[model samples]
Target: MSFDIPDDRQYLESHEWALETDGVVRVGITDFAQDELGDVVFVELPGEGDHLKQEDDLGVIESIKAVSDLYAPVSGEVTAVNEALFDAPELVNEDPFGEGWMLEIDADDTAELEALLTAEAYEDQIA
Candidate 1:
């Protein structure tokens, strides 16, 4: 399956994406990524206060078909995890860019965000 890259976010080659706002960065799997994973069954996420570097593995997301690593899109300490996903993993498949966001981080590199792909670039990447 293929999914459209949203213009509102910055994308990584590994399929994670981040939305920068104020001092916080919201992280999640891209639509293309969740489509590849099929039906999500579980998501194991980091706790608040956990520190992560850019490109670091932060947690795991399990689909009905496979398990995928969730990477940090930027360096930061985790501020919150989406508690709703604990019960409804399909939230990732149903609405990845909205309620399916994995966590919010207290961001460390705002300008470094420029390194990520734009929506056009991300779509090109999968093509």
Candidate 2:
């Protein structure tokens, strides 16, 4: 099966994607992840100002088929959360990369993003 793995971001083996602009990194699940999760029913996310470590438990994403834990892609303070997910969880399924973005963090170390997978590497991993 094929998945949408955008070139502009880095990815985790666990299926989270991170796109850094300036010092902030926006995060969300990969399209393959959402497809596997089925219809997203609920999302639990950290609030603004919450500090997180890379790989920390950021929140939960509940889908019709299973509940999954979302991990932090980069360590830092959460700057924003997608409140739209609370009201329309299906956005996760509909647009995992855009309007479905889960959060944005002011990265503690922007260099950390270098450790993440490139779109080609991620596509290979999922393949």
Find the candidate with the highest TM-score and give its number.
2
Clashes of each: 0, 0
Q: What lDDT is reached at residue 79 by model 2?
A: 98
List candidate 1 stretches off by more than 4 Å. none
lDDT of 2 at 77: 100
Q: Which stretches of candidate 2 lie over 4 Å from their true place?
A: none
Give model 1 RMSD, 1 decimal.
1.2
lDDT of 2 by residue, 1-127 (tens): 7789999999999999999999999999999999999999999999999999999999999998999999999999999999999999999899999999999999999999999999999999988
In terms of lDDT, which candidate is strongest? Answer: 2
TM-score of each: 0.95, 0.98
Worst 10 residues of 1 by lDDT: 1-10
